[model samples]
Target: MLVYHLYSGGKDSSLAAWILTRLGYDVRLVTVSFGILDNWRFAREAAENLGFEHRVLYMPREILERAADMAIEDGHPSNAIQFIHEKALEALASLPEVERISDGTRRDDRVPLLDLPKARSLEDRFNVAYIRPLLGIGYRTIKELTERLFVVEIRESEQLEKADYEVELRHLLRERGIDPLTIFPKSHYQSRVLGWRGQL
Candidate 1:
């Protein structure tokens, strides 16, 4: 079966898509964007390094604006990020050709994840199977697996380059003359997948 894994050019999404391939599913990487910045290219290059077919899908720009406002209001990104993520998942599932979809969300993710009710709602509404390959895995195992399978450049969240909502949110904050640090944490480390183990 063909499955589209929401990709962000990071180890998590890349690993999720790669696992789908190993499980005998024809997997394609899909990167979602709001066109706020030319960030999707990072994901495209990462996909190329993984040897997976990749594509980009534009999401509603207003969704990003709303999420950014919410993040600024809340002084943290959790709820806002989760809201954007769920919406993005819905947008992907609503596509007429999408039957199965997947993402890199893990059991340990605190932000940008869908709960059972939302997941079920999506499945019921779109008739799409939502696959989460890393949902059961913890942080340590995920880190070990990513290290074993990918060549990644790790940097603090604000300094790293990866194609995901955080980048655009930060850009939005900056564009409005607000430092992203006011809305996003300055302490987390993020990975930018350089390539597969030997593909670099």
Candidate 2:
């Protein structure tokens, strides 16, 4: 069966691909570019190392821009969640003969409400299965799996290498005993703060 792995080249995602391959499935790797995190090259290397076809889809920047806007504020908007997963689904649907789509999400990653169920629903609706092999596995197990396969760490692109200014600012605020999310206004307000520094 042909499977498409929603990969970010992160430890969890790569491990998901490895497990699926060991099960005798033909897996293809897919990554969505959201402007901020352009880790496409890393994803390609990971796919090549694992011996699977790799594809990258550049998601519309404006959509992710809106999601970022919502996430910066309130930190609990469903819009951002919808926007991201929708993009991933779109990318997956465009591939040919994709029997299933697998992502790196684990049980630990699904504490609060996200669109994971909706993702599964969409997969079913599209006649494709959404699989999460890493759900039961812990982080340590994922690392061990990658090492056993001699998975090489793919180099991140320059854009992804440079941290987003807002992230850096949030870290700085946390160090100063300030919850950036607590004090910073959501959406446009947070945009203004990041704007002063000339970026988000």
Candidate 3:
């Protein structure tokens, strides 16, 4: 079966794709662009390094705006990020060739998590399986696996500036003369892959 892996060029998602490949599934890497400044180039490069076909999906800015507004109203971006993630999953699930959908979400992931209710609904409505290979793995394990498999670059999320859903929403807010710090909490982290270093 074909698995559409939601890739972000980070350790988690990249590791997810790696795990699926090792399982002998036809895995395709997909990264969604929500009109934010991001390091999507790294995602494409990572796909190349891993020898996987990659595709970029463009999400409307308005959808991101709705999520941002929700976050602003609730005083936290977690719910907003989750909303964006569900929408992303919904879009991926609509693909006829996609029998299963996967992401790099770990057991410790808070925002962008596929909650039980949403997961069930997606499965029931789309007749597809939402798989998270890294769900039961912790942060240390994810890092170890990634380091063992690929050449990755670790940096602060704000520095990369273009790879996250919240980054786009934050940019929108800044453009409107609003401070993102007023909404999002401090010290968020994201990952990037520089190249591949053979397979584990």
Candidate models: Cα lDDT each: 0.88, 0.58, 0.81
lDDT for position 56 in model 2: 75
Q: How well is each residue in 72-168 modelled by candidate 2, as lDDT tens digits?
A: 5645434555456666675676667776887777766642123557766667677888777878777688657655554343332222332222333
State the lDDT of candidate 1 residue by residue for 36-122, as single tens digits: 898999999999888899999898889988988898889888887898888888888999999999999999888778889988998
Error of 2 at 126 (Å): 1.3
Clashing pairs in 1: none
For model 1, the run of ten residues with the poorest summed lDDT: 191-200
Model 3: per-residue Cα lDDT over 59-169, one tens digit each = 888888898789878988888888888899999998887889999888997777877897899988999999899988897988788878888777666676336576678
Name the better of 1 and 2 by lDDT. 1
User: How does each model score on TM-score?
Assistant: 0.96, 0.64, 0.90
Model 3, residue 182: C-alpha shift (Å): 2.5
TM-score top scorer: 1
Comparison by TM-score, 1 against 3, better one: 1
RMSD of 3: 2.1
Model 3, residue 25: displacement in angstroms? 0.9
